[model samples]
Target: MVKVTYEIVPHDGGWAYKLGDVYSETFASHDEALEAVRIVVQEQQVGDEPVEISYQDESGKWREEYSDGGDRPEVEIIDRFRPGEASV
Candidate 1:
């Protein structure tokens, strides 16, 4: 399984969570951002029905495949403002 981490940090004069190079929308406060992360994590845990998925490959060719609902990456949230930690 793939491991995904949501890192909470200050961004755009507010707070937001980042996954790899992507950042979520900014929240007014750290607590608000943390709450948003909690909601996202909870939603991610809910499995969906398997269905045919389509995507474009690097060569610009369209590909379609059946996806398994049970297949999902493990995820966690990391708070950057915790005590004894200077950064995430």
Candidate 2:
């Protein structure tokens, strides 16, 4: 199983959560960002029909692959900042 993590971080003068290079929209506050994470994780748990996916590699080659809808990565959250320190 693939393990995924959402790390809370300061971004663009606001708070956000990021999974690898992907980031959620900036929220006005840390609590708001956390709430967004909760929603996204919930959606991630829902299964869907398997589908073929395409993506570009680092070498700029396009690749197609099949993804199993039943397979969901285990999610983790990391929030290192204390309440008042979250502001960017």
Candidate 3:
């Protein structure tokens, strides 16, 4: 299973959660941002219906396959600025 991590950081003079280079909308406080992350993580745990999916293969050809709903990625949230560390 793929592992995903949401990193909390300061952005746009406010707090945000980042996954790779993508950042979520800014929240007024760290608590607000953390709450948003919690909501997202909860949503991610919900399984979707198994469905046929299409994707481009390495050869640039379109391919279709059945995706299992149970194959969900493991996710976690990480605080970039731990307690006692200077606030970003």
Per-candidate TM-scores read 0.81, 0.71, 0.86
Error at 53, model 2, angstroms:
5.3
Per-residue lDDT tens digits of candidate 3, residues 1-88? Answer: 8988898899999999999999999999998998898899888889989999999999999999998887877887888676642222
Cα error of candidate 2 at position 15, Å: 0.4
Worst 10 residues of 1 by lDDT: 79-88
User: If both were scored by lDDT, which would come out higher, candidate 1 or candidate 3?
Assistant: 3
lDDT per model vs. reference? 0.85, 0.85, 0.86
Segments of candidate 3 deviating more than 4 angstroms: 83-88
Model 1 scores what on Cα lDDT? Answer: 0.85
Question: Per-residue lDDT tens digits of candidate 2, residues 1-88?
Answer: 9887888989899999998999889999988998888788889899989999999999999999998889987887788875543322
TM-score of 1: 0.81
Q: What would the per-residue lDDT of candidate 1 be over residues 1-88, giving only the tens digit for each residue?
A: 8877898899999999989989999999998988898888778878889999999999999999997887776888888586553232
Instruction: For candidate 1, give the lDDT of residue 12.
Output: 99
| Candidate 1 residue 4 C-alpha distance from true site, Å | 1.9
